[model samples]
Target: MASAQDAGRGWSMAGRCLTALVGGYAAAAGLATLLARLLPVARVEATAWGMILSFLFYAAFGLWAFHEPRLARVAGVIWGIAIVTGGAALLLGVRP
Candidate 1:
């Protein structure tokens, strides 16, 4: 049987992994925005919702693939939040 202490430690590590994924995604998105400002991006005919969905979906999937259960769930939540934020930003027409 697994020890309680082991379980606790596992949970903590998983939490850290999830945190890292979400944090990494946010950092990446910010960097992308910066790059977009500094350099011209190829013009695309994509809608705001489409961009948001792709960004968040891939971010969450990336996180899940990189780690175990608890971490995956956390990353998933973070991606979800980002998606919602993206929607809000879209409605407000807030660029970056």
Candidate 2:
């Protein structure tokens, strides 16, 4: 029973780390692609700005993942943002 509890705790920590890394990256990339396509500036300038802003997004998501009380909720929010931004980028034909 004690071992089972420890295993569950370990799995929870691993899940949080995975969400912070993978989910954060996906969300940031999707946001960057959407912004790059939608920005009114020249393509080169917009893309550069988007890329710069994405770092902030990634950092914020990483922080939120650890701070949030529920790992599942954090994962859900990250995935939701990723899906919406990704779909919008696709619809806008953003290539990156």
TM-scores for all predictions: 0.34, 0.86
The residue-by-residue lDDT of candidate 2 on 1-96, one tens digit each, is 225648887788888889889999999999988898889889899999999999999999999999998878998999889999999988877454
Model 1 stretches with alpha carbons more than 4 Å out: 1-3, 40-96
Off by over 4 Å in 2: 1-4
The global C-alpha lDDT for each of the candidates, from Candidate 1 onward, is: 0.52, 0.89
What is candidate 1's local distance difference test score?
0.52
Q: lDDT tens digits, residues 19-95, model 1? A: 65655465446433433333334434233334455566546545654555555565666555556554444564533
For model 1, the run of ten residues with the poorest summed lDDT: 37-46
RMSD of each: 8.0, 3.0
In model 1, residue pairs whose N, Cα or C atoms come closer than 3 Å (at least 3 residues apart or on different chains), thus clashing, are none
In model 2, the Cα lDDT at residue 64 comes to 97
